[model samples]
Target chain A: MKTENNRAWFLVLPVFALVAFSAIVPLMTVVNYSVQDIFGPDDRVFVGAEWYREILQDDRLQQGLLRQFVFSFAILLIEIPLGIAVALAMPRRGRLASLTLVVLALPLLIPWNVVGTIWQIFGRADIGLGGVLVTALGVDYNYAANPFDAWATVLVMDVWHWTSLVALLCFSGLKAIPDAYYQAAKIDGASAWAVFRFVQLPKLKNVLLIAVLLRFMDSFMIYSEPFVLTGGGPGNSTTFLSQTLARLAVGQFDLGPAAAFSLIYFLIILLFCWLFYTTMMQLGRGSQQ
Target chain B: MARIELAHLAHSYLGKPAEEGDYALRPTSHVWEDGVAYALLGPSGCGKTTLLNIMSGLLRPTSGRVLFDGRDVTDLPTEDRNIAQVFQFPVVYDTMSVFDNLAFPLRNRKTPEAEIRSRIEEVAEILDLASCLRQRAGTLASDARQKISMGRGLVRTDVSAILFDEPLTVIDPHLKNSLRRKLGEVHRESRLTLIYVTHDQTEALTFADRVVVMHEGEIVQADTPQALFERPAHTFVGHFVGSPGMNFLSCEVDGGCAVVDGRRIRLADDTAMDGAKQGDRWELGVRPMFLELVFERPTEGVPVRITHVEDLGSSKIVTATTGGGNLKVRVGGEEEIRDGSAWVVFPPEQSLLYRNSRLCGKSAAGQP
Candidate 1:
């Protein structure tokens, strides 16, 4: 006969309880609300997948999804390479490196709504330095009236606000590489480009994966910055998934469809994050052969 | 092939070196012949790696010039100097395949694809890496990675010299000898100037045609292995070269005779003691292998009290005490000796004399 001692499980009971109270209960409530139609606080009717079907067919949700995809993709395309370039150009050592690092991290520490408000005033053609400069160059740039200008202003604002996070990640990755690799590269007569391609790029793969994933998720669920700056802008042109979800759940008070929409939004983010992680990891491993 | 020369080479890691101790390498000059294998032998922190790095153009000497085949290349970059160095730890491009790692230099020079393939195959076969040509370099064992690093150097035929900076430091003890011999064979076939730096006397003796012994950032002596064993130029070399090294005893010289413990020993016929100078420091050195032990007392032999006998499989080491200091003697086979009394005799030809730690032009004597 074998005797098993399970006393170790008591140590993990607190963590399980914390998760149940904080996350599981609230998520279950959302799930419950997704399958019911509430006419009043007490008069609720059961609906089976009707709100899900309505959400899947809504044209506004489709447009919002398209906008979300474009915003996330554009952010990744601009920020990843620009951040790597910034990291590479950074001073490797000395007092100047720390000083530059502190400056680069300043924008990241600002609150999200403050960032949007700052950009909102900064993009006004009447006052801000950037706007003044653009006007001095004789360009018609009104972010309020033109949809294209509004989109451009929001894109530039995000780039300025979040590129430092990616840059800091890449900087640490670059620092992790040993000096022997550079010495060996010099002995091998590797050109600058070849050294970057073969040595630096391969070593940065994991950190770049993290940066991309973070940027993608954050940009896809973006709500606060654009909400304060453009308020879904000029004719819903900049309206993304999170903003649309907020409008349905808070402004319209359509409980069933809003809950169902939130679940779909959650699933979309989960699926994309999974796809990004697996594809990047597979690429890293497949190169071993 | 290149005949490398170091002219008044000196280096200081400090920006402004003030004292003698500030410099890592003191002023020195040496010429390594074309296609000859040499080794820089020293203990740790003895400037052996510093000299090798200077030769490979990885470092610039604070004062002096490096010449390759009569061309001054002191300021040349490493790749332009056409030198390859295998470091203490193997440095392989982790993401590249074994084949690509071996072909990197040739590819950098824009060699044709067919030539690159052939060269990679040749080096891979020589290093016994043909079976792992397609395997990723980072996945190999440490020894295999070191071999790949060495193979990268060997694949470039146009190289003027190949430098090894303690390349076998990370290799297993069982594999060290065979890999050393492989490097030796590679040097022979390529006929390139090969300079190996190591602290191990066995590796220095086995791999190099001539060994340069360094101490305290200066070259003490550069000679053939046999000559280095028979005649060490400095007291440090005498104490550093052989197994158990040479035993040194302080002595006084007067009127062509050496005296230890108030007993006079005759100097050899060709030994010189030009001046009967008094109060000069002198030492007599004799290898442990040259000392003979006799059970019975002789007319003119130093009597010793035996302390211990260590059995080392094929040979035994006898530790004894003389009036002046302790002495170790290497004896063959399992000699039966008790820890009581013994007589030891030194052969005249095998004994050397030193003045102020430098080898003097003289020899000590034994009883006729």
Candidate 2:
């Protein structure tokens, strides 16, 4: 039964090389920048952990981190259940089923920048459809002036754009369920809610986990849509880690702090992603036992 | 338990049924007695599963009514049918423990927790899934998962009937036999109205009290297993219900006899051949087990050229060419016979005559 192990490494070598080239090299560069101070094009100085201390102490970074967490959390909370519900509503067969899926995927296909631009114009109080409708309905809606309005608009846009991915994943999971399960449920006299709770929800766990992690990471690293829409403004209300990193790197021309911030941002995303992955894996294993 | 009666049940996937060909399940009427096991037996696309689904209320029949205990439930949804169904593939909740999967229906009905526990345990015990109760269903082996699916159907005691749609297809051969026997035992002990749907003749014959043979959306015959074997109402039933299937030879009726390949074979009853005329196309059907090899030509026997011989454990199958087609003869013991010279004695009594693919009558007597 023993087999040769010579080919085992061959399969993984390419992936390893790719990851090293794309991720590791840049990560090392960021780490190098974080530990030093860049004075100018040709000048530099060693400053051990100074940028870390500065980032850790700055209230703006803390606020941006908190805002990023809230945004990711809120997106996950809204999208996961809503996506599943939409998936459940989708037809399992026929022409309409595919048509509905294509329609749901349309928002995800739009470029992120375009999505932000479209939402920015669409939510305007004067000429935008959303703003005009809201104003006509007697509600004061202004994304440019109010921080809460800006945040709400950004969150809504994110939900509208990204919930489709979750729904599509859930739809595939739902479609993969053999008709036998539903028949068994019916034979068991299961109520509609019972079937959903016991059969559909449980079956959709893996897909839902993927959806949750993807949405959370994307929302946490959100930069383009909010940047193009609100420019992180009215205040730092819509400012996420990515936007903050970009401002530090591009607007202020502080490469050292910006690199440090980028590394911190990468680590935070990596940390949360690991947490999500581990939690999902543990839940999966626990259920299997 | 409830007796199911199908009153002219017919279904058509097409919106409008302009003709008989449009129906997926043709209008049929039959009654399945409470506490009796029945199998809807047919080949693929024969509408057997469709009938089972209709009976389970998974699909509503376009025409006619379904009655449970004489109560009309034609318009009822599957959830309202009070029937348990085990589908072809295993369908356990992948994320739930086997225990929870088995307890789902009971919990849905708000059954007591203690009752649910005992029922799940009992069903799992019957299905040999007692050791895997805590394991997630998706983690189990395919056969074990299938057992859990069956257990889910069996856990509920208040169901009016249990419908099985080829439930043992994924199980190992040994397990298939044992489960079939177990199902038969369960049916006897509980007196549950069970409708099993399968294309496998052995499973249908061994597990069900009665077999309803279907062909192309029509029920050809519905009778006890013994009757279905002894007197198949249609030629399709005779051909479909046997292991090797009945060997058919096209013939023409000639004066109270059927002449095949220019050889005359007497019919069992002259009255049964009243409508048969010369030159009319007919078929002579006979089971392989009934055909006897004769060393010398008998007074009234058709000649056959032996083509091949198969050594089965308990019996030997002899393949012969008669009338330009292959026919098989099942014989017990080691009978030495040359391939090209062996001839078969078609005992007139053991043969069946068919007109227009419908069995006219059985022939008089032959080797059993």
- Provide i-RMS per model in Å: 1.8, 2.0
Q: Candidate 2, residue A212: CA error in Å?
A: 1.8
Over the stretch B99-193, how does candidate 2's per-residue lDDT look in tens digits? Answer: 98888878877899999998887787788889889988878899998898888788888888988888888999988998988888888888898
Candidate 1 local lDDT, B1-368, one digit each (tens): 78998899999999999999999999989888989888889999999988988988878999999999999999998879888888888888777888999898789988898988998888887778999998888788998999888888888888888888898998899788888888888888878888899999999999999899999999888888987788787888888899989888888876666677776656563455665357668887778888898889876667889998888888888999987688899898677777889988877777677777767764322100
Stretches > 4 Å off in candidate 2: A1-21, A40-42, A91-99, A287-289, B17-22, B277-280, B323-326, B339-343, B362-368
lDDT of 2 by residue, A1-289 (tens): 7886678889999999999999999889889888888777688899998998888888889999998898899999999989998999999899999899899999989999999999999999999999999889998899999998998999899999998999999999999877766877777777788789878887788888888888888888888999999999888788888888888888898878888788888888888889988988777667544
* Error of model 1, residue B17, in angstroms: 1.6
lDDT by residue for model 1 (A1-289), tens? 7759878899999999999999989888888889999888899999989999999999999999998899999999999999999999999999999999999999999999999999888888999777778778998987878888889988999999999999999999999988777777877888989888878988899999999999999999999999999899888988889999899999998878998999999899999999999998776655554
The root-mean-square deviation over C-alpha atoms between each candidate and the true structure, in angstroms, is 3.5, 3.3
Q: Candidate 1, overall lDDT?
A: 0.86
Clashing pairs in 2: B349-B364, B349-B365
TM-score of each: 0.93, 0.91
TM-score of chain A of each: 0.96, 0.93
N/CA/C clash count, model 1 = 0
